[model samples]
Target: MAGPNIKHAAYHGPSIMKEIFFGISLSLMAGYLWKRHHWNIQRRTREFYGLLDRGEISVVVEDD
Candidate 1:
């Protein structure tokens, strides 16, 4: 025969699992978006600098 407290504990387990699962899901999504944005900006910067190095583009730095 099971006690009343044991039944409540059993029901709470799945609710905890659901919360953990959603938390991980949100974290992974945020990480992926951050990585993607960083990669794109780095790529563009490199390409622009590469073009400048080749004398195909001119850069003017203003004196402060």
Candidate 2:
């Protein structure tokens, strides 16, 4: 039931190296993006607080 001259399909080959490379690259990119976003949010929050402290903005509450 086994053939001695069977060839592997074009879509079926060794791709371990490629997979690992892409996986690492994509993860690194995602991590970079996440960190950048976190830093931006932190900076915005700090700026908002600073503005509030300097009286640049105010919080008003309305009772209904």
Candidate 3:
């Protein structure tokens, strides 16, 4: 009886340029997200502080 030989598939990893491009793109995306998050946090904090300073913290109950 003769056994069949199987050839494994070869994998070509990402090129150096591809890796660099992906790294830069991912870094930019992360930075943008981080900056946006910080901006939103700061805006909310400022709003809260402004309301507090003006003594506008009140709860009004409304029936729908």
Local distance difference test values of all predictions, in order: 0.89, 0.93, 0.90
Which whole-number lDDT from 0 to 100 does residue 60 have in model 2? Answer: 72
The lDDT leader among the candidates is 2
Compute the lDDT for candidate 2.
0.93
Q: Per-residue lDDT for 1 in model 2?
A: 88
Candidate 2: tens digits of C-alpha lDDT, residues 1-64? 8769887767777699999999999999999999999999999999999999998788876579
Candidate 3 Cα outliers beyond 4 Å, as residue runs = 1-13, 58-64
Candidate 3: the clashing residue pairs are none
Taking all chains together, each candidate's TM-score versus the true structure is: 0.68, 0.69, 0.65
Better of 1 and 2 by lDDT: 2
**Tens-digit lDDT string for candidate 1 (1-64):** 9657653334434587889999999999999999999999999999999999998888887589
Those runs of model 2 whose alpha carbons end farther than 4 Å from true positions after fitting are: 1-12, 61-64
Ranking by lDDT: 2, 3, 1
